[model samples]
Structure formats: C-alpha cells, structure tokens
Target chain A: MFFNLKDFIAEQSEGETDWEIDLSPLLALMVTLIPVLLLQTSFATLKMIETTLPVLSDAEQKPEEKKKDEIDFNLSLFANKKSELVMELVVDNKRLKSVTIKPDGEKFDFIKLQEELFAVKKKYPKENRLKLMPGDGVPYDIIVKLIDSSRVTPEKKPMRFVSSTGENLETTFLFPDVVFGNITN
Target chain B: MSIVHDIVKKAQKDSGFTLQLTAMVDMFTIMIVFLLKSYDTSTLEVKNVDGLVLPSSITAAAPEEAMLMLVSKKGVFLNDKRLASIVDNKIEAKSLAKEDEDFIEPLFKELNIEAEKIEAIAKRNSTVKFKGTIFMQADKGLDYSVLRKVMYTATMAGYGDLRLAALDGEK
Candidate 1:
C-alpha cells in the first residue's frame, strides 16, 4: 500500500473545514431579546425609610420613670421655616445640648449636619432614635436628605454598639429609628 | 507607482471571512442570563407619575409588602385609586375635612374602610394581624406642610407605621 500519513490526515480533515455554522437564527434571537430585556430592565432600585408616627393612646396617664444614674440621650432635630436645622439633645426630660446648623447661600448645609450627627454619635454611641421634625417651608427632598445625612456616615461603614442584652453588635444603622413629630399643635 | 497601485488593489478586495459570532453569542447569553436572574417581582414597583419625582436615599431597607399611597403634585392616590386632587401645589379646599384642616376626609375614610376589612380578615386568621403599615411615595417638590397633613390623617386612620419610598442611588 502506498499510503502517506500526511495525505490521509489531510484528506480526512478537509471534509469539515469548509462547512459553515448557521448564525442567522442566533443573531436574530439576540437582536430581538436585547430590546425586550432593555425595556423590562428597571435601572433604579426602590428602598424604604421606615418611621413611627405618634398615635392616640387610651392608657391611664402615669408619671415618666427616670433612672437616677443613667442619662439616656433623647435626640431631636427640628428644621424650621427659615431653613435653620436645630439639633436638641434632651436627657431625662431636660434640655442637655442644642447644636444649630445654619444655611449657606440658600442651601441648608447637609454636610455640617452630618458632621454634627457624627460627633454626637461618637459621644453617645448607643443612642438609636432621632425625632425628625420637618417644619413648614422645608421641601420634602431636603427632609429626605436630612434623614439620610443623620442615618449614614460619608464612608457608609458599620458602627459597633452594645445592645440592651449586653451583646456587642455591628450595624450600619445610625439613628435608624425615626419618629415623625411637630405635626400636632 | 506600480507597487502603490498593487497595494490599493489588494486593499479593495474582500477577504470573504465570516464574522466571528461565537464569542458575541457567548457574551449575549451571559448578559441575558444575568438580566433574567435579576428580574425580581417581590419588591413593589413605584409607578411613574406625571409630576412625581421620588427622592434618592442611601438606606438599605428593602421595601416590604404594604398598602401603597402616592402623594404626587397632581393628587394623592391609594393603590392606583385617586383619592384627593391637589391644585396649585396644595390639596384642594373641598377635599379637606371641616373639623380638621390637616385631615384629608377622603383618604381617612378610605383608609378606615380598608382597616375594617383588614381587621375582619385578621380576626379569623390568627397569623395575619393589622400592623397598619403604609408605603408612601411622595414627590420631592411638595412642602413639608402638605406631608404633615397627610401623615396626621394616616395616624388618625390607624395607619401609623409609615414607610417612605425612595429611589436607591448614590449620595
């Protein structure tokens, strides 16, 4: 037999070398699918900022209970009509500290507000609730920005705190509990 | 001159090579798979209103299932039902309750009726209880005065837990 390995291999491989794969259906499918997916795709995700509102109570009125040694910080923020943001820190039903953030050039200073909140958080690491009182003339967007500034740090890192159960916990939550106030007379 | 002419002629000729679609198809498949996987229906979609622009927030709280309330510049709606009409950036005088100017009569009545229905259902089903949670999508342009009125009315109607809906975006 006068057989050459190169010729035999070449002859065997040549059968499939010229065959073309059909890509028209796949191209058409991708073209059709991309538009539909693009139309269905929601670019922005939705989130929620949970807040507790004051409710009517039917329980008998009782005097508030205060511990002798413990000084719990009850933080409250008020945005007045003049765009003046006032942060009042009350401890055991007594006004402890008041920090005011002034507006600069027709815009409320949100960065200054966040810095103050960060400072307060550093001093009182366990305090969790913030009473947001958006007074008249403050826009809804600014209120939302204030809430964001009060809740999160610029770096968006978790802060550590000791829980009521004495367990050490790390959380991204800063003043996560928001109580809406300043609505009643 | 001959060499230049030859090069020009060679450049003009078609190579006849088919486009390499395998890699493109592979990329498309990956993209399609990712898009399909991310198609979540658990979170409620905030509808696109004519004059409503939701504020942006960095809050990581995922939106839960609750009664949806939309407070746009045009009106306040409850689950796509128009309850109050706002004109000139304020709620119309006719819609406000006589007893309390801050109270929206229509919204309060509707919320009360819904509360009744929910309470009735909750009686038989011990697992489900009326927690009074409302997911509110309010416009960014509206004033805090308007929001105060709505929130007051909601509290009166027994829906005290308010969850403000917002677009999740960068600071």
Candidate 2:
C-alpha cells in the first residue's frame, strides 16, 4: 500500500479541530473573584445632601412690598458645645424672642427642639426653610441629627405629602430646606 | 465460579458513571448574575481615606460626579493629595490667611487650577457648563468649624455647589 501523507495529515488536522480549549483555569478565576467581589460589595444604598454657599442675589437685596397677611417665619438654630440650643424666630427681618434650650443629660434635647419647631410649623405651615448655625466646636454628627430633627414634624398626624417616587403619603411636613448659617459669637 | 466472575465483570461495566455538569453550570451562571447585580459600580467612585468616617443621613438624592475633598481628623485632602493638616481641629494659619483672607491657600490654589481647567473645557464644549460643584466627605467626629472653612475655601475657588457625602441612614 502507498503511503498517503496528505490523507494522514488531513485526518490529524480534522481531529485537532474537534477539540475545545480548556476552560478550567478561567472557571477557577471566576469562582475566586466572584466570592471576593461579593464580600466587598455593599448592600447599603448611596445618598447625597445638596448644599450651596450663601450667596446674596440682587433680587433678595430688593425687598418686596409686604402684605398684611404675609408673615416671615424664618427660624435659625444655634447649637453650642455646652449642649445648649438657641432658637431665634425672625419675622419680616425683625428678630423675635429667642428660646434657649439646655440639653437633657449628654444628648442634645432634640425632642424639645422638635416641639418648638412643631409650634412654629403650626403658625406657618408653608414655611419650610430653616437656618442651622452650628458652633465651631459642635461635632458633625450633631449637626446631621439636628438637620434630621428639623426636617420632620414631631406630630404623627396624617397629612398629604409626596413620597420619593411621587406617591402621596399621609404625613405632616416640616422644614426640609436647610441653609447652613455662619456661627456668630 | 466462572458464572460468578462473568456477573461481577458485567456489573463493573454497568457501574461506569458520568457526572451531570448541567446543574453545576446553571448554578454558576446564577451566582455570576447575582454577584454582578449586587455589585453597584455605576455610581461615582469615592476612595475611602484612612481615619475618615462619614456621617449618616436620610437624604435620598444620589451624588453627582465632581471634585472630591476628603476631610479627616489628621488632614484635609483633595484628589488624594493633602492640602492642609488639621492641628487641634484647625487648619494651618498660613493656609488659612496668608494669601487669601479666611480661605485656605493650598486648597484655594488647587481648586482654582481645577476650576480654570473646567472653565476651559466648558468654553470649548458649549453643552458642558461649569457648575462649580464639589463633593466633600468629612469625618463624622470632625468639628463643624473645619468643615465650614473647607466649604468657604471651595466656594471662594468658584465651587458654589457643595455636596456633603454621608452614608445612608436607616429609615
């Protein structure tokens, strides 16, 4: 029989074509990385609080004509390291009586601040802006807690308010817009 | 004895087993999908600095991509570079008042350079406007005064919009 080198080579090549590349190493890598990634992955959602430096606009400088029914309910909260909170209520650019609240033990009396804010909300339900002036020594956590306290009313009465996804919730609204003010001596 | 040997050989041949890999492949596919979905990489990547603990908040707004300023108990860093150190919860006097009044010099310089670059880009691309926004991640235990100075410095350097970074608090 004649030696058929071409036929032999063709058969060998055909056999080689049927074989698949080994994926065991790649599979091993995926297995290792998947678990590590899972361990490093965070389930907690990310959120943000938008703020702006106090910039006085020209329109703000020019005061509008005041009406009889209009009441300026601008409120400012001053927090100090001595666990003291001084809340000032301003009406039409005039400072009203200031209420000083001492802390209950170590923690700042957020409940008292809430009660005072709730009373202010009762008078001006449409007023949602608040100025938070934290002292130089006040910690960031307390400021965040104060902002949270100011954002919601203490009363659990059912009122109409929009949820995050545009759904209406039966909840009373409080001061949601916060303007961080300078700490004054 | 011959009959018993033949039966044993036939049983051995019948016992040749094959593994069913379809179930394993299905499980691996599900695991990969779940891991990919659970890992959220689409948001802005803010590197966690050492000795910095962020405050927790109930705000639902997601952070936008901007310049990063990390305020730790040790120092203040911008883009992983230390701008100034906090000595007794106060920035260096030179950085605070030497060149500019009340603004940190090093921070103002760095932020001004970045602002110029951003403004140049905005000028070239009409669609891109300079929002003058910056993201600040300060330590939870840091004094408000330090944060105030940082914010003031950023504002002076043309960063009007400030986004304070905080962890998501329990509802």
Candidate 3:
C-alpha cells in the first residue's frame, strides 16, 4: 500500500510536473565511458612505466681525479730486422722511456722486459694502463707472448691497436691497438 | 500515448553513443599501441662525409652519431671547410700556420666550439648525447704520417672519439 501511494501520488510545488526517472540514457553513458576510461587509464599507466625506468648513475670523481684517470700512457712496440724489437712508451706523443730487445737467436727474453715494465708501472701509480701498438710484420704467436708478458701484474694494462678506422675491435679491454691488414694474394 | 511512451523508452534505451564509440575506441587503442612500439629511441644516425675516401679496415666499427672530418686527396676538411694540405708523407707544419697563430691550436679552438655546442644541445636533450664521433674519412693513397697526425690532431681537439668512414660491407 505504501509503495502504491508513492507511485500514484504526484507532489506539485512551484509549478513542477511529476516525471518518471529514466536510467537507459545513464546506462548508455556509462557503457560508452568504460572503454574511454580503460584507454586513458592504460595510457597513463604506460606513460608512468616509461618514466620510471632507472637511469645509470655516472661515477663521481674530482677534476684532479679525472685528469689522473685520463693520463693515457701507451707503449708502442715497433719491430724491425735490425733491432728485432723497439719498445717505446709514448706518454701523450712524447717518448717517456724506450728499450731495445735484441733477439737471442731463437729465444726471446720477455721476462727481462717484464721486469723493466714493472718498474715503469710504479712510476704512474694512478691509471697504470699501457696501450700497446704493435707494428706490422710482428708474428702472431710473438704478439700473444708479449700480451702474456704484459699481463705479469694486474696493474699492467693490455694493448690497443691503433687502426686508421677508429674502432674498438677487441671484445675485452686489452691489447689496445691491433691493425687488421689483408694478406696479399 | 502508450505507443509514444514505448518509442520514447526505446529511444532512451538505444542511445547509440556506446555503439558508435566501441569500434572507434578499439581502433584508437591499436593506433596508440603501435605508435608506442614503433617509436625509435635513438638519435639521428650520423652520415659519413661524402666525396672523401676512407681507409679500409677489417676491424673498424660503425660509429654512432659522428661529426664529419673529411680527409681527401687534396686537403684536410672539417665538414667542407679546408684546414690544411696533407702531402709529402707528413702534415706540413707550414700549411697549418696562419697569420700569427698556429694551425693545430686554431683547429683545436674551432673543433672545441663545435663540440661544446653539441654537448650543450645534448645536455637539454639526452637523445643526442653522442656529440660527434670524429669521422676521419682519410683516403687509401694518403700518406700514413699525415693520417696519423690527423688522428692525433682531431683526438687532441677534444674530439677523441674517432671514426674512420668506409663503404659499408667493404673490407
């Protein structure tokens, strides 16, 4: 009976007319909004994810420390028929030290060169890396042996080949400068 | 009146708003997804300087963004501007000397300016962080000593990251 009264009785105030509430349009509106809301929400979520990617932090160092780190000490080994081996430590274009390794017939004395190299290592206590540039005509096996000799101490760095094409060819950061030359047919 | 009420109810029930937008929303979603996926995160690929013959290398690598420093049979160029004559198995020091200032120092100053500008732009936009790889497109017949000095000069001018340009896939 109370439900009937509420349904039947129409209250009139300030010239208002009785009307039934229609939910169909509201339902349609909500249905339309679902996909838009989903899209916007997904876009916002993806944008947030992209922004949250971690950036690598650079190692902090003082100017003096950086300068010390940038001191490029390179040892260039030039082999000729006369001397057999000419080892020169080129510190920024100027030769800081040099040594001549004479071939003792069939045997090469690498241990003596290693001892001398160790002495030079103590000189530049900071960033004691020595980039090695071996000239052409040096045997492959000899180059490998020199590499082993250069690695006598953990402090002693490997060599890098200085090719005309500026490329870091080595997979590992050692043996700095090795020019790749073509074999003549 | 009952017929009119039925028509009104049907009209309200079938507003067509949701129906119209369903397909549009799907299309937009797919477009957005593809746009996000296909976007290249890397900066502009630097092209090697044209007309300059680069020394061939089996071990040379492809550089990222690079600044073109063309070394031709005629002269040394920093992106079209002639810097010096490379001849006689050596970089003629006389060729590098200007009115009073030295050639290498002036060249250094110019290169530094370019590098600083690039660095500044990179600072604001990280997508272009690699300022300029010094692309030494030196010719094959060029003197080795000249090439060596060019390498040294470019490296000393705050453009140490060197790149020798070459024909792709050619040894």
Candidate 4:
C-alpha cells in the first residue's frame, strides 16, 4: 500500500499532470483503526459499569465457615424513611452531616453531601471507618441509591452499615478509642 | 514590470501559507467514530426483594464478578432472602439503627455464611477468589444508624470492595 501511494504521487509530479489525489489510503487507515479505537473506548465504559458489583458466578460459591476476624472498618449511614428524602451521615462514630432530599424528587443535593464526604474521605481515604444505620421501611432502592450517590471521584467513600441497638454489641471493633471517647459513652 | 503580475507571482510561490484541511477532517472523523464507540452501554437497573427503589449512579461500576447483596428498606437479603431484621428484639428494619456500636451481628452472620460458601468453592476449584464485590443499594431516606449497620455488615463479611447505588445526575 505504501509503495503504491509513493509511486502514484511520484508519477503525478513527473507528468506535471493535474490529477486529483486519491485519499483511499488515508480512508483505509481510518477504517482499519475503527474497530481498535471502538474497542478501547468500550472497554473503559464497560469497566466502570462492571465495578457496580453484579451477582456471583457458579465457580465462585463456597460453603459457610466461621472465622474470628475483626472488621476492617466500622462505617454506617442514616436515612429518614418516615419523611420524604431526608438523610443523615456519620463517620468513625461521629455525626458528619444531615441533608434532605426534595419531596418526590428523583435526586438529592449530592454537591452538599459530596462536601461532607470529601471531609471524611480526606480523613480516611484508604480505609472506611464509617457506619450506615438506616431507618426501617425506607425504600431499599433509596438506600442503595444513597450509597451510590455518596461516592466521590478519585477518592474512597466511607463504608455503610445498618443500625444496631443492644448492650451486648461491642464497639471495640476499630479505633476503640474513637468509639469510647468520641462516638459512645 | 507590471505591479499586478509581480504580486501574483510572489503570492503563488508562498505555498507555506496554505493548509489542506482534508487530512485534519479525516483525523477528526476517525476520532469521532472512536468516541461514539467507546461510550458506555446505557445503564442497568437492579431490584431487591421488596421492590424498594434504588436510584442508579454513573459511578456504579461493572465488575468481573456479579455477587451483589441487596439491603432493602425492609430487611437484609442476599439474592433476596430475608436474613436478619431484628435489632434488640425488634422486627422493624427502618427503626433507628444503633450507631457507633457493634450493630451488624445479625446481618454479618448471614453474609459470612455466604462468604464461606464462596470460599469453599474457591478452595475446591483453586481458580477463583472468594472475594465478591458488594453493591449497597440503600434508600435515599435511610437514617445514619441503619446505613451504618448495613455498611458494617458488608465490610465484616470479607467483601472489602463496595459500590453505592445512586442516580447518575444526583452525584
């Protein structure tokens, strides 16, 4: 292909002829790269979608076994299902912020929440130390949506948890000092 | 020498000033085609047991594995099985979840069971890892306590990677 185009151009110059330049080679290059370029973009797009964590495959199931390992992080969230679109945030046993979603609105003010999350992410970028304890009967989808919404780009969002209330429950899982000194009595 | 003839000759010799945009246009056309191809496959919607609605987010990622545990507003579920909903002898899943306390005992038990099952499978095959990704599909109105409890349970279950489900524009 290269030799043909070189010769064609040379011949035109030698003949001093006003012939139209054939762009077939350039078009061919583009046509060849179409699939490769398409594949690259699609791969990235697919990667982001894949991270949403779909269901597990068969070759991946294991039977239940008990192990005594402490939780890596203690994190949670609070959603007010009684009212419309109201939610609160906590991190490392501390109340971070409480923001409200519009009644019957499809979205929440994530920009404000992102600020709160940024503060927490700045404090604990690698490990999640927050807990998410949601109220009863709040739409399950809303809770999931909140978790998805709380994430910040280029930063790790805190972990979430359901609320618990019992004296038998222990708060010494992570940063025991924070549980006792700041989050608990 | 005629002034117009001299000027015309000089202008014709100045070839550097002219640019052929045909090549540029070709490059742009190829780039546009690639960009369109690389765009993500629209978006996907997933549901839990109770039909609780979760807003999907653009940040929600696709994973190599598809082991998602759905925590609905009603109770804790895996693939939609009721695992635990009681907190201190309570049946409600929406009540104020205890905060800063060990609030994930019941939920963790269920998740740990599932994790062990996966681990056992991985052990048998020796080709897969038991580490499945978790997508937390929490409601928008969930309180801090309940949210925390759910988060704690997922982390304790040996699922370190987490994805929060939300609508795209919301974030």
* Top TM-score hit: 1
In the range B1-171, model 3's lDDT, one tens digit per residue, is 344345547665798332333455456556555555544333322224443443332223434555666676667777668777655434556666454222355456668788788788899988867433565555555543455455545555545455455433222
| Candidate 4 steric clashes | 95
In candidate 2, what are the lDDT values of residues B68-142, reduced to their tens digit?
888998898887899898887787776777555457888889988887888899998998887888888888899
Off by over 4 Å in 2: A1-40, A56-71, A154-172, A183-185, B1-34, B99-101
Per-residue lDDT of model 2, residues A1-185, tens digit only: 89899988997787864444433444555667678878757666556677667642345475778778767677999999888999999988888758998999988999999888877766566678889999888999888878878887554354554543466545455787877878221
Interface RMSD of each: 9.0, 9.4, 17.4, 12.4
List the TM-score for candidate 2's chain B: 0.78
DockQ of each: 0.36, 0.27, 0.06, 0.14
Better of 1 and 4 by lDDT: 1
lDDT of each: 0.81, 0.75, 0.48, 0.49
Residue range with the least summed lDDT across 10 consecutive positions in model 2 chain B? B16-25
Candidate with the larger DockQ of 1 and 2: 1
Question: How much does candidate 1 score in TM-score?
Answer: 0.81
Candidate 3 segments whose C-alpha is farther than 4 A from its true place: A1-75, A79-185, B1-53, B92-94, B97-106, B123-127, B130-132, B166-171
Per-prediction TM-score, please? 0.81, 0.75, 0.38, 0.38
Considering only N, C-alpha and C atoms within 3 Å, which residue pairs clash in candidate 3?
A159-A175, A159-A176, A160-A175, A160-A176, A160-A177, A161-A176, A161-A177, A161-A178, A162-A177
Query: How much is A11 displaced in model 3, in angstroms?
Result: 82
Backbone clashes in each candidate structure, one number apiece? Answer: 0, 0, 9, 95
Highest DockQ: give the candidate number: 1
